[model samples]
Target: MATKLGKQTYQPDNPPFIISTGTVAGPFEGQGPLKDYFDHVYTDTLAGERSFENAEKEMMANACFTCLQKVNVTPQEVDFYLAGDLLNQIISAGFCALELNIPFLGIYGACSTSAEGLALAAMLVDGGFAKLVLASTSSHNSSAERQYRYPTEYGVHRKPTAQWTVTGAGAALVAGYGAGPRITTFTVGKVVDQGIKDPMNLGAAMAPAAAATMVQHFADTGRGPEYYDLIVTGDLGKFGRELAVITCASKGGFDLSKNYNDCGLMIYDTEKQDVHAGASGCASSALVVYGYLYRKMLAGELKKILLVATGALHSVTSFQQGASIPAIAHAVSIEME
Candidate 1:
């Protein structure tokens, strides 16, 4: 049975294992520093598909397929498929699930969908309700921009705080026992609204939520910043990463300056890439956690890691209605055992 801790955290008695992972990156991401970490990189955003939306779905399906292929696990062997995306109605996840033909559980956590799915998948396996589960998420730059902000053809001037949506997908398979990292703890965050209404500044809106969850995770697990080899936030870019470090020190007295980093900052070379703030989207942390970090863990460089993926939960309708962005962060503690 999973043990609840400090109101929002859960420590699984039999921690679930992340057996395999798959990641696919887009052209722009292919030029990034961690480009070699990805299993596949698309030549173009379309990926031979007619529309960006279709291409996003293809990427997600391919990611899931890659995971299964690596472990020789058939789709029917997986008990459930948990996935989500930044698309309207989570169309990309839905289409990917349809292709996989697994029992599907669609989730929506904005950019935090990756961690959210992992947490739920771990819970199901830890509870003995599932033998194997697949968690996947994806985002496409052109498709997300058209739905959330502006169409690519418009070429609207972006603010300095605006982040580039990552065009990619990632998937991981969780099992009751496996030869990989173990998911020991999960911290679920509350929806926090800081009264910020600007849709472009997502990192600013999400930093508070990320801080709250990190604080709670530390308190619940009786651990501090020094517990993990590395602590990473999902898409808090250069500016928001600084804000998160300051907020953690002020609120929880936790100094994260030494071993902490953000996926948004690590995913792209902000100096070289045209991305203003950095990378943002479901695939931002997904690609880093499943590709780069996973490979490092396998090489015995990093034994433990804490991934806190944050999300700005606001829709086009809510933004237009002058509603503030409500953000959340889900934390997953993975350690090699």
Candidate 2:
């Protein structure tokens, strides 16, 4: 039986292992600092497709196929496919599902979709409902921009706190029998709003939510920041990163200065890339988790890791209505046994 810890945490007695992962990045991401970590990098952001949406679909499908190939599993063998993205109605995930022809469950957690998918898949497998499940997500700089903000063709000047949406796709295979990093537990977050309304400043919009979830995770697990080898945030850019540290310190007495890091800050070189603050979107945390962290865990470098994927749940309609951005973050605890 799964144990519910505190308010929002779940600890499964038999945890599901992340057997394999596949990641693909766009041209911009290919040029980023973590370029070497990606498995595939598209020279053309459109990826030979007619539209950016099509390109995103192709990237996600390719990532799913690549994940399956790593473990030599076919789509037919996967019991369920769990995925989501930033597009409206999750079109990217839907198109990818159409190609894979697997049992699909489309989810939406804004930028936190990756972790939400993984958490749900882990629960499905741990609950003995499925033997294998695939969790995947994607986000294109072009696609997300048009959906949430002005199209890139507008060439709108970005604010200093703006975070670049990641142009990439990342997928992972989760199963019960595997010798890999196991997802031991998870904590789901609620929508949190701190009255931040600027769409460009996603980091600030999401920092409070990240801090809330991190504090809840510690409280639920009865562990301090030192319990994990590293505590990673999904994409709380630069300003958000600093704010999260401050919020955690004041809110929970947790000074995460020693072991905390942000995927947004780690993924790109802000100084050269001119990405204002850093990176965001679904792939922000996905690429880092699937490409960099997974390999490091296999090499025995990281024994225990906490991945907290944050999201800004804002839409053009909501932003236009003068509503504050509501954010959420989901945390997955990974451990190598």
Candidate 3:
């Protein structure tokens, strides 16, 4: 007996879809002068300073505004908004929506909000439920730390695997069928629980989720890693990236050590930033993909790409209860024609 399976292609029957498959940025970048301030404080050179949260919110708002402008779409034009942030109660998303005065749907995926938001928005477009949708995610180190773990004045040391929460935001608009890169593929992830207890070790905790989702994505799409120019994971950082490689190698019988890269590691050069490794948070990977790589693809630097955003599915309440941290990852494939 013989069996046959169908292959999925990028052809859309209705119309050519061009989603806000990309993003824009604001002026202020990550960390800012905090590193310099820390260095000066260590040497007793300076005394008081302003709060990083205020600065981060300002930067985030600017980023959101700039992204809205770049897409040439007004708030009224957007049918729905999907947004998330690292801050408690999603202040950034809330504030952004309040300022824009559009219908909103706030989400929480820890650091993986980018992929989740895009996935949901893509579904809406694909289902013909809405014509245009905007999705966004953001994170600020100061805000996240204060809300989840520690205070900025504590100056606590972090584990090497820990990623610095990115102080940025990224927004993209997904449109109905048009002429551009469409959300060609989506691999919904499953939550994988690993018995790692350390909150500081997010990379280790989330690595398994990234690995599981990547493997499932390849299996579902019936495609190999070679099909993509780049396979980018969200904020898995250095440790998680290595673990993901090991997981994929074990399952797929391929070495992804060289081809696999993590956005957490790429956002800020650790040596220059003195951030130990790199960045994390919801916006960490989102900004890099939307602001950097998307532009490169548009410029013909890349053809096909697979973006996997990983998140640690642990909250303050869950962590306190000694519940194991579960991680989730979502993947989307984009191609330029």
Candidate 4:
């Protein structure tokens, strides 16, 4: 049985939930200035023939399958599947489900899908509707750019603050009951509108959302940044990270300048001109959390972590309309026993 730690009431019939396992990356590699940013790289001849969409599908499927194997759960044991991707129709998630042959609940949260999926999965378990749940998110640079912006061959100049879409995937298994890390709290975010209307400069567009959600998370939980070992933001790049620090300082009366880190900044050594200021995209936050930070937790290097997944909720159509870019963020706090 899962015990409720906080003052909030848990329904008597709520199912116990735990993230039993997870996996990341895939069997396809791309060489660019930012090649070294990824933790796992797949280099093989067969990967060359597949389109970006197909590669993304395979990556997501591999991640979910590996996660299931780690938790000793079969496809049939999963009661609900919630997933998302950066593609137009969430093609990767849809195709991955087809291969796994599991019932699915697709989601669209731009880059915040990982937390979004986790929150939803936790809810189902908490509602006693599921015993086993799987949630995941994936993104590929080539596919995302072609579908959302421009083609890779176009060679358009990007702003210095623009984030590099991560070519990776991350998945996790949330079970009804377990001794692993649990979802302690999910800070639901309000859409923060800073009225920035620049498609090329996503950092500016997303900074306010990150700040708003970070502040809200601290307030909702009645905890400060010192309560956690690490404070991580999803895909906010270097510029956005700075902005977030400043904004958070103003609102929370805490200087997060030294303690704050961005997944985008951690993914690559931008100083090497490999990827300018690291990685972005939906997979950026997921991979960093599941691959890098999760390992640290397992090693007892980190006990608590606050993860804020940020997203720019603007489409090409919305950009053309000169609509102010609205952004949303979701925060999830994880602690290792």
Stretch of 10 with least lDDT, candidate 4: 5-14
TM-score of 1: 0.99
Model 2 Cα lDDT, one tens digit per residue, 171-247: 99999897899999999999999999998898999999999999999999999999999999999999999999999
* Top model number, lDDT: 1
The stretch of ten residues in a row with the least summed lDDT in candidate 2 is 149-158
- What TM-scores do the predictions have? 0.99, 0.99, 0.86, 0.89
In the predicted model 4, the residue pairs found to clash are 16-176, 33-274
The count of residue-pair clashes in candidate 1 stands at 0
Off by over 4 Å in 4: 1-18, 26-40, 44-49
- lDDT tens readout by residue for model 1, 57-165: 9999999999999999999999999999999999999999999999999999999999999999999999989999999999999999899987798967888999999
Candidate no. 4 TM-score:
0.89
lDDT of 3 by residue, 221-319 (tens): 678888888999998887888888988889766667656788888777666676665678887777777777777777788888888999988888899
lDDT of 4 by residue, 213-297 (tens): 7777776567788888998989888888888898888877777876779888776657764566557888888877876777677
Supply candidate 3's per-residue lDDT for 29: 41
Give each model's whole-structure lDDT: 0.95, 0.94, 0.71, 0.76
Which residue pairs clash within candidate 1? none
Model 2 scores a TM of: 0.99
